[model samples]
Target: MGQKRSTFLFSALCFGMAFLYIPMLLLIIYSFNYSKIVPVWGGWSLRWYKVLFESEEVWSALTLSLKIAVMNATFATLLGTLAGLALVRFGRFKGRTLFSGMITAPLVMPEVITGLSLLLLFITMAELIGWPGERGITTITIAHITFSMAYVAVIIQSRLAGMAQDLEEAAMDLGSKPIRVLVDITLPLLAPGMVAGWLLAFTLSLDDLVIASFVTGPGANTLPILIYSRIRLGLRPDINALATIIIVVVTIGVIIAGYLMLRQQKQRERDMQMAAQEVVKLDA
Candidate 1:
């Protein structure tokens, strides 16, 4: 009976994995097809990739997306770090609960509503100040930052929660000013969390479609918007090629990050062992 149950579970897991990943694998594989018709695969070739490279629209869209992602990541990390510090380090203040809810409102709210609201606000601002002449890269980046900051704040909050407060408290006790302690101790300890938050923000910005669609104006088509428009017309081989490229790039980044993290872990372990040995010598 146990063997039968195990077999059933294994089959279910395999089916689940296939269901999730098979379409992506097929997309990657079909990227190399010479045929323009998606289903009719005529021998493997990189024809579409070359064409995708030459297409100015794809390049423009990708450039806009990358720019927004980078800007959003940077600003989100800074603002989120401040917000996280306020949430975790600062004692309860007036409207603390309200502030926390406002910070996290983007996380739970529907993207359409978020987009519509921001659009309305932007329109109001433009009328009031005559700034942001048209919704484009700037508007999109701001929209991304609004939501991306929430993810960053969450990551930073979790990190701060798990982190040792001893270093911070000790710094304060040793005549270090609050700002100095924050800069030297807290920020350094929070480096990993900041990096993680930045990456998360970047990914969220890059992947966002609905919010960006509402915020962006003419000439600011993001990669997702471009791909979405094309997919609406019909599946293009170039789109498949683009997806495969993104997959390859992301896979490589993950591998490199993993390797660096492993190296850091090993170095920390060695340092801890050496410090322990030094303590033993002092005791002796």
Candidate 2:
């Protein structure tokens, strides 16, 4: 009876999962449907996909989104890693709590509030310095980086907290300069966390729509903004095709990330085993 109950529970969970994804799965399948009406089967064809690629505006928006995502992700990771290192290394120094709160403020703040505040700030800066005349690509990128950096900082801080400081101390004891120790030991150990942070920031920036909408100006529209405008008119097969492409890309990325994480785990296990063997040899 217990086995049967467990099996039933598992089946129910699987059904729930399917139920949640069925609409999305059907939408994707129907992207290739030749009929205008979506959510109903017409006939399968690749014409929509071809049409999507043929549109210069779609390609332009996609390229712009990629560029902004890359820039925001890189900046966020670099700055956030530095912030995390300081938080971990400095510990409970002067105003540590305040500093930490400031670092994570972006994470809890509402997106609309953040966007409005940033828009006002940009306007003030542009008036004072005459740089960014209006909200544009630069503003959008900055806004993305602001929120994305918080995520990176949180991830890096968690990883740094878990890491033992003894390795870094040992390097220093072995006559390595502080910079050398950080470069060779600390940075290497923190690499996985940093990479994870970068990936997270990249995904966030790429997926941002609300924040992007607030900060974007003429000729600076991202793919999400363009797609959203189209959807407001009516559901198009092109939009379905676009959604399907995005789903496929995201799915592949998740799979790749899972594979990389498993590989990293295996590598860490092997290293731990080798270290144990060396310790045993020394003891003998």
Instruction: Using lDDT, give the best candidate's number.
Output: 1
Q: What residue runs in model 2 are displaced by over 4 Å at the alpha carbon?
A: 1-4, 267-284
List per-prediction Cα lDDT, in the order shown.
Answer: 0.95, 0.91
lDDT string, candidate 2, 26-119, tens digits: 8888899988777667788988999999999999999999999999999999999989999998767898888899999999999999988888
Worst 10 residues of 2 by lDDT: 35-44
Q: What's the residue-level lDDT of 149 in candidate 2?
A: 96
- Predicted model with the maximum TM-score: 1
Among all windows of 10 consecutive residues in model 1, the one with the lowest summed lDDT is: 88-97
lDDT of 1 by residue, 174-270 (tens): 9999999999999999999999999999999999999999988988899999999999998999999999999999999999999999999999999
Q: Give the TM-score of candidate 2.
A: 0.91
| Clash totals for all candidate models | 0, 0
Candidate 2: the clashing residue pairs are: none
TM-scores, all models, native as reference: 0.94, 0.91
